[model samples]
Target: MDDHTALIRATLDHIHQGVCIFNKENRLVGWNQQVANMLSLKLTQFRVGADFDFLFRRLQDELRIQSGTSPASVLAWVEDRGPRPPLRFEVRQRQGRVFDIFAQEMPDRGFVISFTDVTAERRAAAALRAANDLLEARVEARTAEIAVALADAERANASKSRFVAAASHDLLQPLSAAKLYCASLADDTLAPAQTEILSKALNALNSVEDIIGALMDISQLETGNAPVRVGAVDLGRVLRQLGDELHPAARAKGLDLRIRPSHALVQTDASYLRRILQNLIGNAIRYTRTGRVLVGTRTDGDALRIEVWDTGPGIPLAEHENIYKEFHRIDPAANTGNGLGLGLAIVERACALLDHPHGMHTRLGRGTCFHLTVPRAGLPPRDAALPAPEPGTDLAGLIVLLVEADSQTRRALSGLMERWGVEVLDVASGTEAAALLAEIDLVPDAMLIDAPVDDGHAGLALIARLRAQFGQVPCRMLTADCTPGLGADCVLMDVSLLLEPVDPAALAFFLASARVSG
Candidate 1:
């Protein structure tokens, strides 16, 4: 062979793939040793004068026919003798070996074919497909498990909310009775030492009541049960009421409680807004030893910023984020107030429900200012403030109907009303109360019905019946249920709602007002 021909032959033999060449007459012109090895053919079979069709027939006999290709189809393709386009296909030998075959027609109407071992590539592809299927199956199983776990967690949370409500209702019944008994005793003349003991006892009871209330609030807010009624709320009136209520506690601590007057109307849930400010102002007054607690409102762009500023020991930087967590306290040793550390948690949740943004600013050793922004509504009505009943108002000569399920609470409350010179007709159920009133043929000046009276029917239903029977008498519904829609129901029925444990002062005010109106 010439130098160039020798070099070409050497290159073709060195290649990994089998190589073969054909001449115009369809006779073998060139060949590589790899072609013989890949096709399992003897080197002696590779003669220069060998026909391409004969070589292909020999290869077909040595290899298994591909799935969709028949011996007839192969014979037709070989006999056509026409120019063929480049073709590629995979085939397997009967001995379980895979090969890739390629054929390309030369310009002279002859064709060359090559073979390459592909057994390892096919095995690796199959293994990869199996691994992918396994991974997909595992992912699907895990996803199903997570879905079931999440459903279980949600059910547990709902159950927890129901349990808390039931337990609080049961607990508050006795607690209200205790508080009423204490109030009754306080009215009796006693020795100086006995009076002090009674005062401390009342304080202890009040602390317990506060803790229970905080727990109930936290439960409602956390479990998404606290109902929000957004409307135009008179901000000034709420602040004034809170100021009047908390003034005594502030004065007792020698702190100035300043509530700047504002007539701004805002869109929010009145009850929640009141509670948020109540907790913030109360917290300020509690933490502040001898400084002023200021509450006021200022106008932002389209919102009102209500702020509660206090001159007290500022919170540490590290404790800022933690203050909103349940039962988390800063300087617990120094906190002497009746707080369960749930105040801020309630504020945070309530604000989130209302979509109100609340934040705080503080400086160590100076004080802290907590503020919340609320969307402002139009001008408030001309008369926003209702006349508050005078403190220590008398309820004497008032015939009040008390429908309490618990006997202890009924007796205790009756004694308290009697001590206040009021006549109380106490019954354990709505049926008894109605029957007693009918027997006596007497119309009470006011009614105090425990919500969900002993028979498990709502007090509002009873109130409606009583009003229908005996003209619209001033009515109040005493309840331990803080569920949503209770307040709206009471409002629609024109009955006041006093949540248990009922404050003696609030109960007295309702009776005094009812007596006066009657």
Candidate 2:
């Protein structure tokens, strides 16, 4: 060989990558030292002029190379490899090392093969996979912990709701009794000055009750305790009752409580609708000093628009958005008679819960109008032949069974019943009533049962016992606030319910109606 050829051979010996060349006659012509090291070939058998097949068989057997087949099969594959394009392949040795091999045909018709070690790349990929597995495990554990914390928070909120609900009744019982006593006292013969003083006291008592009741409702609604029940609601009946209840107060203020007659029924939660209208109308009455507060309705496409128009100090455009926020008022310093400013907040929440659209339109000092759009009920129109309840029913000489737990409530109720000339048997519990029933010769014509009595079941138990013995006597269940479940129980018992602080006149009317129905 020439000197240049010898120098090239020396350079190939010092190269890092394994390289081998075969002549056109398919004999091994040259190879670097790296080829022998990489394949673990015996240098004695890897001589120049060795047949390419011999060299290939020696490398394959020594390195335990895997070609997805046996050594004989690989030899056959190598024999069939004629003139072809360049090719690349990967292989793993028995010693757990990896390699990338490249083979190409030279321009002179000789073949060259080269190999590179890739074992480190494979090890790095393995470490990355282990890290990914650890990360996934930690994420799953954190998700489980968050779910447990969420459940704990929900349970705590429910417990708080129950405590508030029970406390509302206890708080209102005394207020209800005092209101009843005031009403009974107003009926007595007294001087004009004494009568006027008693009237102011009654007004003060009513304002206190209104504040307490509004707070309880707002608390229940905000805490997600009040369940939303959507159904067809008789807006006409609700408006009429609301107007009747608040008419006395409006007249006392010398403002007109005008409720236009409407036969429109709408799709909404009936109780929630009542509350919304109650707040709006109550605000109208409380704010308006001289003019009128009109509760009216009109049809707007497939919706019924119920509007409360009041001749009161109108809301400013800037304050309109802020009005629905909790404890917000247009005139903060003005004495608007015991308003905590939660009325419109309750209205806004009720609208959102029902998915109903609501807005207000007002002009400075002309009047303010608040309206809500309720979806028109799809049911057929109400039958015109349906009869209304007979009013002004007399209660003289009617025997009434009254079950009340509070001492003041019992005395106030007894006094009201006596004033109406109705015979009342007032007891603190169902057990006492049963014992009294055994002793009394006269049977009760109707029952007025106080709900959520001792153990939360006494009122219901008494009703069932009375029904079993008396056979469907007309009964009225009285409560501070009638919860949804208790309302369902009242329906099942086929009885009427009166929420406190109950109006004495309303109670007397209910008792008289019960006597007539019995």
Q: Model 2 off-target regions past 4 Å? A: 1-131, 185-208, 380-401, 420-422, 425-447, 453-476, 482-497, 505-518
Clash-forming residue pairs, model 1 = none
User: For residues 41-76, what per-residue lDDT tens digits would candidate 2 score against the true structure?
Assistant: 667767788887777655564455445545565444
How do the predictions measure up, each by TM-score?
0.81, 0.72
RMSD from true fold, candidate 2: 5.9
Report lDDT (Cα) of residue 182, candidate 2. 89
Question: What's each prediction's clash count?
Answer: 0, 0
TM-score of 2: 0.72
Which residue pairs collide, candidate 2?
none
* lDDT (10s digit) by residue, model 1, range 349-400: 9899999999999999999999999999998647544444555667778899
